[model samples]
Target: MQNMRIVKKPGYAVDSVDRALQLILLLQETEWLRIGQAAKALGVAPSTAHRLMSTLVYRGFALQDDQHRYCAGPALHPEPAVGAERALVAAARPHLEALAARVQETVNLVERVGATARYLATVEGPQLLRVGNRAGTILPAHVSAAGKAILSTLPDEMVSAVCARQPPHGGSALTAAEMQELQAELRDVRSRGFAVNLGRTEPDLAAVGAPLASGNRPAALALSISAPLSRARQIQDPAAVEALLTCCAALRLELETQGRL
Candidate 1:
């Protein structure tokens, strides 16, 4: 991240607790984090950083690599999240199938999680060659089609804050310039009412997605259609977009009626 976005600290915020929480957020953002980087980000001494990380490692919330860099550990993902997602998958199944039938391509449902998007469910297409199921997959929110759509629904400042934490690791990480470009893309997605991914997440694959609402309020859920790069144009067609939006609306309405949204 080129610049640190300002976080409004609560008046009663506990310094040790807050620093530990910030460290957790940092670990969650980057694939790997050096102790020095953590100390710098949290404005704590290197010794304090080590002690903090020791606690996280003890709790299984963080782990150290051979190089001593910190990364997210197993405890970061809890069973409650998976249980809630299972309910979401069941509620959205019919619409996912409908969207898959309409586009005749792989259809996916994703939920935005901080700066990432989690693939909760997918309905594979009938084509001989197509994107397979990505259920339970997690990708950066800025790169995935549905993730962008979900982020577009958030306030601009919130979106910027989310993009600012992009870790400095891997080719998939968005740089400062790339984050700016994503801002521009989100603007178009907001106005166009849908988002597109042209091989951003994976080469030779293209996808389009639209955000959905929960109980009349904007939510972090999106439904997208993925296809082979050769069928990219087909997925972006007006009919495909309409079909996606129609299914999202229907699903949103059903969930709202059932008090599930």
Candidate 2:
């Protein structure tokens, strides 16, 4: 005769709070849940599941229908601001494109990623022959105007940590004293509301970058334009600087109003 084995129920008990919360998160992606189905899936008793659902409903994190089903409640979700970075890119793209066309220079969107500044997007100038930095490319924060513009808004300690974490292009990285001097330069950037990098990242290349803010995150985005050093000198022109400032102002307004620029 074939051996027959009987299976025994596991003695371990799952935590009720975690299970209920997991169900809540799962429901976020779904429309509604029937009591029987939800309880069965959670491996909990119907009465216990009903009590948990009642608590969620009481707190406005869930709602129950007359048909005896539950759905997510208004309090379960706050206005989503988590995708602010993507929103920032979308918000800044048109302006960057227009500016690139007008100036015939490479325009880029840059953001801080860990200890370095990473390119978020790039729009090339009118010239058929143009150099473009790929999105996700990173550079030292101290070297690039696009990096420095955003760095200028960070706290001194945080800036020091970031710079100390990586060596500068030429040597053993910036000293604390040198970091202070660089901080002074950033202060100027703050006052000027823009930063200038002349052959710091790439030889014979010059760039100008301005900051964009959203909510309490200061200088969350940087807008930049780059050109050959000779052509970059044109950035010193009063009219060009004015135009850059105007664009920065517009970006700031857009970020403030739309909460993403």
Candidate 3:
């Protein structure tokens, strides 16, 4: 008991600093937490915990609900701004280049941020005239091939939830029935072993994608190649789709084997 040395209060220190740090760590375990739950978890008085949470919220390190529950704030989990986005673009360059080289079209590595698939990296096609998509471009997830390829791998509940938050193109919103339809489409993508956006998002641009796995989770990343819809229609050879599947398979294998994705 003597070695335990519990200090209930520190002399001349910031109010509730220890408890605030503990709150941060606890929030890291989940998305959001109630103030009462946090108080109970930390075994602190509810009022004391609330005060600490208020301080954190004031600093943009946390947010509180109308009922006074707390969540990790924007400052602590800042969205990828210009600098981070640029870094992602830089890191994914080689892979995008390789995928482009293989498919002979513009290749893009994209990830869904909220309801949009933001281009993280890209490489030009080998042909003189080819579709070009650059980094920082954000497109609707339901419409983009890269978005579908990645979204197809997510759980149905999650996909529905995200789609619900955003308006779909050429429509007011996606109904539950429509979301289920999207899920069906994703299942087909999983069955076909690839995702295709046939000018769904952009006119005269068509693309296909395969999943990139990370650990037990599969398709955390996606590799997609895009070209003019007219050219894509002419090159509807079954072998080409097969080749894209092979690339996805190889990339997944390489990522797993190398312990990185």
lDDT per model, in order? 0.82, 0.73, 0.70
Q: Write one digit per residue (lDDT tens) for candidate 1, span 39-64.
A: 99999899999889878875557765
How many pairs of residues collide in each model? 0, 0, 0
Which segments of candidate 2 are over 4 A away from where they belong?
Answer: 1-85, 166-173, 214-217
lDDT (Cα) of model 2: 0.73
Ranking by TM-score: 1, 2, 3
Candidate 3 Cα RMSD (Å): 12.8
Off by over 4 Å in 1: 1-81, 167-174, 214-216
Estimate the TM-score of every prediction: 0.67, 0.61, 0.60
Weakest 10 consecutive residues of candidate 2 by summed lDDT: 164-173
CA shift of 99, model 1, Å: 1.2
lDDT of 2 by residue, 19-131 (tens): 77877985686677777777887888888888887777655566554245667765566755324555777888898888887777888888776556667777888786565
- Report the poorest 10 consecutive residues by lDDT, candidate 1: 166-175
- Model 2, residue 167: displacement in angstroms? 7.1
Please write out the lDDT profile of model 3 over residues 1-50, one tens digit for every residue: 56776766667766467778888887677666787898898888988887
